[model samples]
Target: MAMTAAPPRVVATEAALALIARLLARHGPLMFHQSGGCCDGSSPMCYARGELLLGEQDVYLGDIGGQPFHIGAAQYEYWKHTQIIIDAVPGRGGMFSLEGPEGMRFHSRSRLFDDAEWAALVAQQPACFQADQKL
Candidate 1:
């Protein structure tokens, strides 16, 4: 049987949540994208909702601290076994992210999901696909 209480593949730290709340107050709704490309590498980039254009190749991983997070499908395949953890650090953010002006940047931290967690996530895949709620 499938797991009924699957954990999200992505989450945020308390500090990250606090920062996200502040950004929301100033920018309204927001979203994040972790691109496995050049320049920022795999850093999480924050944007006010609708500011960034998502391509067909993008995959929505899930929400973190209530903000939707996405990644390239190719990247998702590489990261599928890990849980993404968003955190805040004092620095300039991605040049275009909303937080760049706030002197705080969003960072990506990850760890491989434990065996049980991985199994539960895999079990939830069918439900996730049926939802078709990619943001």
Candidate 2:
């Protein structure tokens, strides 16, 4: 048999996707981009409402804590080699983290913090926040 490799699939289930759709439905469009960051040339960031660089691109959907969200196409395109999946654990909520196919890692977006997960997410992204629900 010819051997090959498949890219990582979202770990979340259908229910999660449904939830994400609901959460994002009211929050406006899910946007993504590459920005200069501490570790390297750039990092992936998500916005609840804003103009997207690419108006038409495939968006990734995944759910966390019964809330749905999106990952922008441009962001995925840049980091496809790194596993791109929503970390939908309960307390962790839903956030994007880069798990290198090897070992190193990085993250962006708000940690899937329900009314409780806020503290840690804040610590990680103190200045990056959404005021009036506009991130």
Best by lDDT: 1
Give residue 20's lDDT in candidate 1 (0 to 100): 95
Show the lowest summed lDDT stretch of 10 residues, model 1: 126-135
Residue range 1-135, candidate 2, lDDT tens digits: 432332222333454344445545656544434443444434443345444444456554443434333445665445433433442223222134222221222233322223323333233333644332221
- Taken over the whole model, the C-alpha lDDT of each candidate is 0.84, 0.38
Best by TM-score: 1
lDDT of 1 by residue, 32-110 (tens): 9997878776789998898989999889989877889999899987887888999999999887778888889999989
How many clashes does the backbone of model 1 have?
A: 0
TM-score of each: 0.86, 0.30
lDDT of 2: 0.38
User: How much is the lDDT of residue 95 in candidate 1?
Assistant: 78
